[model samples]
Target: MTQRTNVVVIGGGQAGLAAGYHLRRLGIEHVILDAQAAPGGAWQHTWDSLRLFSPAQYSSLPGRLMPSQEGELYPDAAHVVGYLADYEKRYELPVQRGVRVSAVHRDGAQLRVEGDADDWRARAVVSSTGTWTRPFIPAVSGRREFTGRQLHTVQYQAPAEFTGQRVVVVGGGNSGAHIAADLAHAGVDLTWVTQRPPRYLADDIDGRALFDVATARRRALEAGHTDTGGVASLGDIVAIPPVRAARDAGLLRAKPMFTRLTTTGVEWADGTRADVDAVIWCTGFRPALAPFASLRLRATWGHIATAGTRALDEPRLHLLGYGDWTGPAPATLIGVGRRPARETARQIRELLA
Candidate 1:
C-alpha cells in the first residue's frame, strides 16, 4: 500500500523534526521517515563523553528549549539524545522509525519516497539525512596495510580500549580534537594530526557566537560582499572544557598530517615516524544523499543545489540540515529550526496552493 502525505520528510532527526513542526503548524500533512530504530538520530551514535559547544538553553528547537542537564554546563551526548526523544514526543511529530529510504524519484507531479517497509508519495519531499553515516577517511598510502587498529568517529564509543595505548587522532575538526582529548585524558600516548595547524576558537566563544558570525557572513554574501569565511575565520575547533584543559596541559597539541601510513604506524615527509597502536579518523563526512541518487540533483560539492531550501533541478524537493549550502548554519540545531524548516514549509505551502 502506498502512503500519501502532503509532504514526506526523508529523515526524522533534528532537521526532519523541525520541518515537521512547521509543516504541522501550516496545516500541511506530512510524515517523517527515519532510518534509526529509535530517537536521538546521530546523537545516539556519538561518543559517551561528547559535549555540546553551548549550553542547553542556547541549543534548542523551534518551540522548546533543551532542558539543562543537572550539574552540567555543557550537556553530554546522552542528554542530547534524551532531549531529542522528548522533543519528538512533545511535538507529536509523525515519525516512522526504522524506515530506511532507498530512493526518491518522480511519479507524475508527486515525489515518491521508497523505503524498506513503506512507500510515501507526496507533493513535496524534504531530504534531511545528515552526514553521520557517510564518514570520510583520506586515501593515504598503506592505510589498508597498517597493522594498528583503525576506526572512524561513528565507530568510537568511550576511550576504554585505547587507554595506555599509543594512538594517533587524525583530522583537525571538533571531533578530532575532542577524541584526542578523551584519549589523552585517559593517559594514552597520543599524537594529534591535522592537515594544517589546528585553529582554536577563543575561550569565550561558543556555538552561539559561531551562529551569529555565520548569519553575518551569509547576509554579507547575499548583499554582494566578498566572503568573510564566517566562523571559519575564528577557528575550526571550539574550545570546549575538556578540549581546553587538554590543550592547556599540552595533551591536545596537534602535529602536521603524516605523509603515509606504514605497516607499524606512520611516516612523515621528513625522516620522522611514529609507531602507534591505533589511528582514529575524525575525518568528517559527506552528505547522505544516496537515497536521492535517482534524481541526480547533487552539485559538484556533493550537496543539492538549492535556492533557499528548494532544489533547483527538482522543485518538488527541499533539502534541510546538510549545511550552509542549504541555509545559514542549517546543520546545527538552532539553525535548522530558525531558517530552513520554517522557510521550506512556507515554500511548500505556497507551491501546493
Candidate 2:
C-alpha cells in the first residue's frame, strides 16, 4: 500500500531540507526522501580540502544560523556536514534516508513516488535533487585511450594519492582552481587547464557578493533595464584565501583547453602535448532529474522549465535548488532557504487550500 502525504520532497540535500522546514512551518504534512544513508547530502562526497566561499555566518539556512567554527573563517566540508546534520535534527524534519526515489508518475490526482522498498502518494512532489550525482566530463577524443587515471570532482579526495606524480586538472571553475592548488602543494607537478581564461572575483567577494550580484541582475531585468553585468560579468572564480594565495604565488596558472586526450596526457590542436600522470575533470554537473523523466518536464538545457518553482509542464511538480533556473541562488544553503523554499511551500499551501 502506498503511504499518503501532502507533499513528497525528493533528495534530502539542502534543497530538500529547506522545502521540509517551510512545509512543516505552514502545517503541511510532507516527507523528505534522501538517497544517502546519512545526513550532509552532497557535502559528504566533497573532497576533504573543500571550503565554502562564504563564512559560516553568511552561509546559513532559514530558522537557524550555522555556528562559527572556532578557528576557520571559512568552514570546511566536515563543518558544513555537521551543521546540516544538526539542522535536520533541530527542525525535526521528517527525512527518511537510504530511500532512493526511482520514479515519479501521476497516480490519479496525486503523484506516485516509488522508492526501493516503499511507495508514496503525495498531493504534490517537490524535486530538490541537486546535481552531485551527474558529474559531466566533456568528451575528448582518445579519452578511452588514456592510460592514466581520470576522475571527476565528485571522485576526488585528498591530494596525498597524487604525490610525486605529474597531474593535469581540467576546467576553469572553482573546483579546477582548488584541486590544482591542492595538488600543487602536495608535491605533484600540477597543470590547470581552462577553455577560457579563468576569471577571478575580487579578494573581498564571496558567496554573499555573488548572491547580491545575482539579485541586482534579477532586479534590473524585472525593471525592464539592460543587463547590469550580474555575477558572470564580475568573474567566475571567487578569490578565496587558498585560491588567491595560490594565484599570487603563481601556482594556479591555467592552460588552454586541449583538443583531445592522448595515451599519456592531453594534446592541443596546435599539436602541443603535455605528459601527465592523471587528469582530474573539474567540469560541472547537470541536473539529477533522471527520476523525473516520465514527467517530461525538463527543457533543452536538461533542466525543468519552471515559472518560479512550479514546473511549466507539470503543475504539481516544483523544482528547488537546481540552480538559477529554479529560483535566485536556490542551490546555495542560504539561497534555497531564503526565498525559494518558503515561496514553494506557500504556493503548495495555497494549492492544497
RMSD of 1: 1.0
Local distance difference test, each candidate: 0.91, 0.90
Q: Estimate each model's TM-score.
A: 0.98, 0.98
The deviation in Å at residue 22 for candidate 1 is 0.5
For candidate 2, the TM-score is 0.98
Q: After the best TM-score superposition of candidate 2, give how far the Cα of residue 194 lies from its true spot, in angstroms.
A: 0.4
lDDT of 1 by residue, 264-347 (tens): 999999969989999999999999999888898758778778998899999999999987888888998898999889999999
Error of 1 at 83 (Å): 1.1
Clash pairs for candidate 2:
none
- Residue pairs in steric clash, candidate 1? none
